[model samples]
Target: MAEPYYITTAIHYPNGKPHIGHAYETIAADVAARFQRMRGRKVRFQTGTDEHGLKMAQKARDLGITPRALADEMSSHFRVLFDRLNISYDRFFRTTEDEHHRASQAIWLAMEKSGDLYLDRYEGWYSVRDEAYYDESELTEGEGDEKLSPQGTPVEWTVEESWFFRLSKYQEPLLRFYRDNPEFVRPATRFNEVRSFVERGLRDLSVSRTSFDWGVRVPGTEDHVMYVWVDALTNYLTGLGYPDETEDFATFWPADVHLIGKDIVRFHAVYWPAFLMSAGLPLPKAIFGHGFLLNRGQKESKSLGNVTDPHELADRFGVDQLRYFLLREFTFGQDGSYSVEAIVNRSNSELANSFGNLAQRTLSLIFKNCDGVVPPISGHTDADTALFGHVDRVIFQEMPANYDTLAFAQALEAWIGAVYACNAYIDEQAPWALRKTDFERMQTVLATLYIVIAQLAVAVQPVMPETSAKLLDAMGLASELRDFEGIRSHWYPQLAESDFRLVKPKGLFPRIEMPAEADA
Candidate 1:
């Protein structure tokens, strides 16, 4: 079997429509999945909806529909947006699925059998909007008679019969886990935050609720439902067929990473690992909590009237451009601000001017001048040799490391640096003018350019799949040439040497005009 690699995005909630923030997370996970697949790994990429929550129940009630109906309708919206965005998740699971209920109950029983779960009366400050409970010390007085959680969401005092997990019991072990495995949480800052929270001490987490009837029922209880986060987080294992002893479960039980937003880092980094430890299960290798996508530096919220739809964004700007701009515009772990103006600027300058222009110009030269056949160089100068070596070095060496670290912007920088070098090589050699004076040398230069463009096409496929396929096809290369091995010295040169036929290549990305109303 190929080496297994499993990655997942925090599933979207079914209470709301999918937004740009959801798309950002899915696209990031997709990029990682695609890169790993191209590198010959057996990859399982999971994304889905969290359907069981008080928010969903209330939203369904307000909408005059059943919660399951609401979940079906809203979850379909996420699927549609993901399909449009080309997120290649192997499974888009829903927490309401039968298998997921089993997985949740299995873990619950295991933890309970281990003496970590206890029946208790719970009273706490809860944020319905956040699906979280907060202590008085952690809350600030909001409007008159209201208190807000640390996240600024309004809280209500909630009391109920509950099942509590011994989260406090795991605090020391969690600290030791963090110390022994420093890289278990990413970007260092986020890891330290989680550590500090553990050091301040942990409270036994309420893991089931009697007040809500919208979630998975507690394993042996008739009146209580699993806490929404417990039900929600188990979807990860459900996607892998946990408790079933299936091959996917056996191979991918300990996921390589759990990709989540910063807002929920505590849930994934603190509560999740503790649950796994209690159940005698291996933990996920990493929990990467990435920053939010802001609109004009403000969080996109419905009340703010600024929640941008992913479909509309894709409709306005091409899918590939949106994908590239979102990933490249932000450093992967930091907050990123997006605007129509910034989108147009980056699209026009980088895609249209740099990559698109170079591809179209070079491929058009080959079709018009070289009889629709790929041309091989007659000779190699020291400078020519150096350029070829540089492209080779980037393709085989630097890019894999960049993708491994999730440094997509830095990866693009490396690929585009080689792109710029190819552009410079064209300007210096003047391949177009050389076609008339020394046809063979001109063919050589164009051939060199062809390899550079083809290599670039392969490198960027994770970010811009459709455009990259188009780029490769226009170069008269087969679709099979897309794997990382395609860039290896063994196969690429042989194919480049053999091919002389080419297709008329058009501009891959069209420049978008600035919208009349965009943020400054």
Candidate 2:
């Protein structure tokens, strides 16, 4: 059997229209899943919408519709946007689905059996807007020094009969888990944040709510419903066939990674694992808290009127270009700013000018000079082998860590470095100059370029799928790539043979013009 690798994105809340930030995170996860599969791992990638929560209920009320109806309607919108973005999610779980509700109840029952659950009359400051309870330290002064939620939303006090998870009991265990698996929390900074929060002392969390009727009902209690996070987090397990005896549950249990935003790292990296451990289930292997994408000078907040439609971006810049730019612009696990000018610069400089131009000139030169036929390798040269090593190092050694860390920008940079090397080799070797004086050495030059260009097409495929695919097709090679190891082995050697034809190359990324108002 193959090695199992499971991954998930935090189920998005469908309380509002999809934005570029949502597309950014999904695209990041898509790259990870694609890379892992290329490494020959059995990958399961799950993404979904959180359909039941106070926010969803309120939005539904505002729309004059039932929560269930609203969820059905809003979920379709999210699905459409994801489809347009070409996101490759394996399972799209909805918290309102029966499988999720059953699995959530099962988790509650298991925690109850383990004595990790308790009944209590909860009295505390709660933020229905945030769907979170807050401590004094977690809150800060709003206008006039009034207490606000951590997100800066105003809070209100409430008392109700609720079930609580004994998170306090497992604070030491969680710290020990962090100690045992330091790599479990990602990006170093996010790990430190979780460690700091746990060190400050764990507080028992309210697991159920009595005021809202739009959530999963607590077992044997009509008034109490599971908290949104508790209910939504269970969708991860439910999507894998939890609460039902099945092979998928056994095969993919305990997800390998949960790729989430920095805002929700606590719920995933800390509370989530404690919940699983208390239920006697294995914890996910890792939780990567990736940073946000800011637009202009601020985060892309709808309140600030800065939200950009993902479809518009895709329309303006090709999807593959946008994906490459987003992954290559920001280092993974850190906040990065996005602007039209910045994206245009990257496209023009990196994709269009560097990579696309390399392919265009190489093929054009071959078609014009070599009668559209690949040149045969004639003799040995140390420079030729050394250039091959540079490209080989990127595909074989550097890529794994970059993909493991989700730093696609670095990975793509490494690929671009190889492209730069190939172009420089062409300039230094002067293949055109050698053609008249040393035709044999010129063949060697063309053959060397062939081998590395073939590798580049395969190595960078996962990052820029459509672009890489088109480039490979233009090389008259079959548009299929093997797994990373197979590609590393070069299973099909005929791909770089001398008789291959140089098919016409098309523009992979076209330049975009910025609006004149922004130019000032």
Highest TM-score model number: 1
User: Across residues 1-520, which tens digit of lDDT does each residue of candidate 2 receive?
Assistant: 5688889998888887778878888989988888888877788999989988788888989999999998888788888887777777889878888878889999999989999888898998888777788887788888885789877788888789989999999999999999999899898888998999999999899999888889998998778999898988888889988888788779888888899998889899888998899989999988998888988768877678889998888888888888888999888889999898988888888888877877777777777778877776777598898898999998787876788778888898888999899889888998888879998888788777876776887788777777777777777665445456655565334654535676655667776677575587
RMSD of 1: 1.5
Q: Each prediction's TM-score against the native?
A: 0.97, 0.95
* Candidate 2 lDDT: 0.83
Local accuracy of candidate 1 as per-residue lDDT tens digits, 164-272: 9999999999999999999999989999999999999999998888876999988779699998999888888989888888899998879999999998999999999
Query: Which residue runs of candidate 1 sit more than 4 Å off their true CA positions?
Result: 490-500
Best by lDDT: 1
TM-score of 1: 0.97
Q: List the residue pairs that clash in candidate 2.
A: none
Query: 324 in model 1: Cα distance from truth in Å?
Result: 0.5
